[model samples]
Target: MKKIIILFVAVLLLASCENQEKVNKKADISTITAESITQVINELNASNSGIDKFLMEKGVKHVANLWRDSDGSEEEFKAFCKKNYIADVTERELVFQKISRNIEIITGNFNKITLELLEPVHLNTFEQHAIDNEFGAYSVDSHWMNDFYQNKIAFIIALNFPPFSLEEKEANAKEWTRKQWAYARLGDYFTARVPAELLQEAGKAAANSDVYIMDYNIHVGHLTDAAGNRFFPEDKVLLSHWNLRDEIKANYANTNDGLEKQKMIYQVMQRIISQEIPEKVINNGKLEWDPYTNMVYENGKTIEATPEPNERYQQILNNFHANKAIDAYYPDQNTFIKRQYDGAKEISAEATEKIFTDFLRSDETKKVGALIKQRLGRDLEPFDIWYDGFKARSGMDESKLDAQTRKLYPNAVALEADLPNLLVKLGYDKERAQWLGDHIAVDPARGSGHAWGGAAKGQKAHLRTRISEKGMDYKGYNIAVHEFGHNVEQTISLYDVDNFVMNGVPNTAFTEALAFIFQKRDMLLLGITDDSPQKEALKKLDLFWSAYEIMGVSVLDIRMWKWLYENPEADATQLRDATMQIAKEVWNEFYAPVYGVKDQTILAVYSHMLNSPLYLSNYAFGNVIEFQLEQQLKGKSFPTEVDRIFKQGRLTPNQWMVEATGNDLSATPLLNAAKEALEELK
Candidate 1:
């Protein structure tokens, strides 16, 4: 109001001056002091921030649309800068044509985003930029990549796995496991290599942004969730998954030089579903375990046995064991993705008992029948499903019982500023932690509560986040942990890229490896551990079990889609049928063999298929690497030695594994974690 009043008075004074030229001269001649200029800049940003956000979103859409073949002849809308131009004399209109003739990737000739253009560019400096530009959307792409690949190659050299050149393929279990882990780790390394040059170019462009605003588009545009939608996230799943075919899952099935990651991973899968600790899986003595593979054979005489250790069960496991679906994607035991799989699981509704007493057994929910009648509350809507989940987590902060995180890192300008100190506490040294401190920035923007991505442009990179905000109450905090992993990579890669092109990891999972590392920080933050609290045991079980749950869904995603592709005749209905069958198959193999669960399709609620193509694997990968990194940090601190390791930017994923943990990123961490949990349960 005061500003408006002042403006009105200024306008009146200007109006009283009969000459417009004089007013213009006065406005231009008046010099603003530095403090006033800073104030104005802040105020202007506060007012125009919405418009800026709107433009960024539109820009992202524009970039996504540019990947399409515009008219079937490999022509795309925005594959390159528009150059041909002409002007009309009287109307002052400009006419132009785009330069998009040579690009084939945008025309869909390739489905993955591998920087294949640079695969052969090793040793040649002059022609390297050529390949980088071809693979990158911008020019500096080569600069970032050249350095990134070197680190990957160096790491691979150290691992000393025998190379597979599509020739000498057969290998033993141990050999195959080594190969599977390497390929899985390297797929991202090479893929990220392709974009190294692109990001390098992007950073350069970002630096000269103000002068090039008209030509360039936006960088980090996010979307708003619709009333019935939170179904998607910033479309990040898609963006992150965009070039997956060339990255992590390129040779997804044939893990070790075409031997098979599925087979290696599957070896343990069998143990999880059927291995027990001396008791049968029973729900009130009911015997509902599947009897397919759980049989006994003595001296060539076969006997149908109860589901037990060392026995296989059902079609999914049987098929996997037999190499039928060995190539399938299975993230966990309980949840697997099959397009048609109606995967579901059960949990107790917190208010079920109260609802049943009032006889308000409407169509709300079988569990919560009385909330509407007894307490005047509404029906058990599906949206309220997470009420119990959030409450369980947020309940920790019943009072202002927590200290402000900023107190720990007084040097930090934001909450993210606290990351270094926290890292040191968890195990980082002060200097490296401070170096990390310098690279990150906390935006305080309303993030969906995930740690969010870090953007690196020019010599500096900044990390921005919107944690501790609305809707971010607890779930957001959990996500904040996971996101921190992503931002750490962003900070490391952007600020510490080897040659600028080789400055970051090779793929989403490479960053995921780090984010996975950071996410473990939450328990560290609360000072909780293996012996912390009674509830921690249950929470840990939920965490450990949830990974198993997701493993099934992840497998379903890989398998069902391949099934659909195999059976082109199948529609949505056919797809769903095959999916449900796979779900039940998996349940019988893992859960039924132990917990006795069946016909559960709750896994379908996962948003990946609706948004991303091959993201389920990342969660599984995170769990896997979490084990590796945690082992590395188990006794030592991070900032003392790890932050520099994290800051090493362009290390191929494997190199990072060796440098950070002195081992390969593998299933051992997670497998050990699970094994430990099982032992405790005993």
Candidate 2:
């Protein structure tokens, strides 16, 4: 899975934007009068003559914005602010430290609770039950924010540390100390006082979607051509999107029929995109499916199979509705899109779009595509969008690698045992590796693997991946290694950062960057080193191609959401059509010229689109960051650099990038390196 661990409480806290008047009409929760806010600020400023007037004004306004009638009367609200505001710098720090300590306890334990509840659904530990879905979807922390407000804890924080807008944060970033940044993050919370019910409902929608995607597996073994020829193993079952895409990559080693198998997988992906796949065939091995004909057979007899009734699109629509429910509550950010980009990711949607599109349309893209075509000695097909030829693993027998991995890691425990050894292979000292390994827990995943970072220092980050009874296959091993990268970053960032609030990197993309770095060195950890003169150049080419593929998917996801917001009332079928259209449009614009194919819906096959909501861009951004960091890591101590870089904590993306590598995050480095690599390889 491209997704890392999602903090459910953070998800609930996140809010979007709407028109101020529209928001007021919907909730009208804030009841504090303008006169009351001014009076409170004036009184506080008079008593604490040395306190910053601007801070006093901002804190009062911030608290007043989120003050609900249920919280207290205007007089009570004024009294609460006057009584709680910390005027002295030393007292304010004390308050901040106490709140941070309590927040970590609350968030960490809540995360642990969610992890435990999700075990049955997320891990392959036991037989699943219907109740598992309900339990997993339950939002334990939904009412926490409301409780905070009612107890006046939220007011105290807002009154003392008013939140800063994205613009303000960026403008003052250079001047703000780490403690100031941590305080600003505190300000980020309690600004949006969304109802607990809406939060729970949204969490339910997201959880259901997660379950839907996790359980969506295709019995590829049961798939056959019209001639009754089967290509995949009889026991082979692949999850939608992740395993299917990996299967396509693995097949490149099949010199005899690689293209044929890839085409079959592409056909399967199209059926999934169009929702024409037989519903009975999904996650059911007894039924036979011929994706090309969109037919199903039971007991070798033709059977009538209903198409999956836009359920894929329904998941997206559900999430859209769930998030839209809380739109009115966020006075500052009215749209979920804004919250996702500006609030959570700390990157604006417009800048992200430009980054992706510019890289997608770059001359390097076609140059790389042309090189891939020359290597293949054939006309490009749509599935060539995921061609993995540039990687060193290309043309290697994946089955042999699978066998090796299975032998090496017979179970999750075996992998867990070797975590430190793997880290040592990356140049970390044995002691440091052992510390990281002790801090990370590995488990058998029911779905494709993901890294769920720890919410606090003492809590162990979890690396969950699929492992068959036979053993961990190469695909699982590869994903495990990637997640290990995330675990390492998550551990260092949380435990080593000076402030509790600055516990993570800027966003998920930064973690993804580390994961990519670790994944690229997978073979080296296995004692398989490439001494070829073209090794460095090949690496750049691979990164360029990987960026090209994921960036298109990211662009598709972005456009799909834009369409969703524009036509929010559209039903599932309408969403299906709009999504597919946007996918094709992205394909035509960025991929058609390279592939000599148009209208391919392959980009729409990412499972993340249904659950993670605007997460695909992180992969695109991660690729760029990975390439740039790899450039900076030349001849450096890998583990030392990673530890130092991640410890910089939750600065803005560019700030973190510059501090880490003396350069801002950009695709320019990757593009230029790819241009050089192309010439070197030629």
Candidate 3:
């Protein structure tokens, strides 16, 4: 599934990864001086007698950093800190428990509200309207930070449980208790006092971009070649770029027309990337388009058509501006790129870049590309980056699979009913499978599928996927399987984990790892097992190639954002041009030698670029994690291992991987496996 990040969950999962930098202009609003902060800390420790002097100093300094003129005068700030800071261990534990419970209540209900409001915009249950967009864009919890500050709840949390930087968390995580981790997570909540209006604006921008992406469908059946040859069924409409990309993958099974269809689809992708596609043809079946010539026809007559305005790039800029608006609020992690990489993923941008580039430049990458070219009996096209030939179902007729899936899942309800059974097929006991199924609510989606995890226990995680009027097709089923993996991880991490504050994986990549695990087993769940002797080799090759493909795209995503930061004032057209150039540059570096082609813009066609900023790396990282976990699960009980690993819950990526697989997160395992797989296949 082409997934969208659940931003609400992401916000709550912030680990506040940076120490307070020197007070900038925005942070200079604080009236409390450093001398007053030190005086308070010393006074609190002196009175408490046995208090942790380290926490006293850290907590006072932390509060002062967040303190503003509105908070109080210097004396008032000192008094508030002394009064609220809990020094006794027993009392501190009690306060932590209470704070954690109340936070869950506030955040959980806010999530429910957002989910309900977005139902019309996100789900297929209702017709979309302007009002739906307005409601969807509304951020109910935007005022909660300000409200918490007014009640001194924010200050209390900050003072009692001082925020830890990524370095501190990693260094201390080995020795800290679970409760200490929870305390650090709570401290993460108030590190930034961004105004409610800025939060609402960012939320509005994200929602608008999502709505635009959800509705951006391409009427593929209306697409024709120069001789007026139409390849797809008349009713076929595919959304860009999820369904369109999937369509290319599906055509790999079409023995006769597969290459031709792929080339045509590639042409269509180029048009979309260049914004040369006719505006009238988007989401409209009334007009036919010859993507090759950038010409449109109405009722067999050529019609003058205007290309789509740079609305795609405009969405990118909208998100950029929204992020930039609140940049000043985050003193340590000022840029959205920094916040996303350092705060959200808990991995530095440079480290992530090195990891991806290293894998892209691996000898195994070239070997795999060479093997793919050999399998195809020809040179690879740029679209061949998504070549699906390694999987068991690769050459199997997709129409047959669609027919099977359609019959099995006639509607969303049918699939929902079978969730437990699917789990059973994966070695889960009946009771456990039923429990998981009961907590996951499946819904038909308007866009490509995504998994929205529950914020609190007893709140069901949502699995949303596209279902046609006729039934669920193979593609939808495949996506649902992937999303089902997310729901399983969600259920495990929230309901089974040790801490309420640590109720998710380290990042979305971890959840995506679990999702990939489930997706690889879709055919098995249907009793179509791959018993090939070379199955292990194929699996390794599949993961290696998948990682190679997305890592390149991930690199492009990073570069594009870097470009945006460099050219903050650039408009849509300029941004579009820059993005295309970056995509080509990335392609040339990693893919040109393999494909025997250069300057292909196919990597830029991911829908995520416009909607889900900086999310492509998660997919690449997911592939890496998935491979490592797969290796670990080699001889272990699948259900038991999955339950155990995911329950580790919100540790740093490296820590979680080490605990789960007894190895750090690295491309070496995958690359080594691919090398061995090559030997076996040979």
lDDT tens string, model 1, 416-520? Answer: 656677667766567867776666554432212233333324222333333331222223343455666676677666555433333455345556656756664
User: Poorest 10 consecutive residues of model 2 by lDDT?
Assistant: 12-21
TM-score of each: 0.41, 0.95, 0.96
Regions of candidate 1 where Cα sits further than 4 Å from its true position: 1-421, 427-431, 443-472, 526-543, 567-581, 644-659, 680-682
Scored by CA lDDT, what does every candidate get?
A: 0.36, 0.89, 0.89
Better of 1 and 2 by TM-score: 2
Report lDDT (Cα) of residue 400, candidate 2.
86
Model 3 clash tally?
Answer: 0
Candidate with more favorable, higher lDDT: 1 or 2: 2
Residue-pair clash count for candidate 1 = 49
Per-residue C-alpha lDDT of model 2 across residues 147-169, encoded as one tens digit per residue: 99888888888888898888888
Writing each residue's lDDT as its tens digit, candidate 3 over 583-678 gives 999999999988888889999999899889999999999999999999899889999999999888888888889889888888898899999999
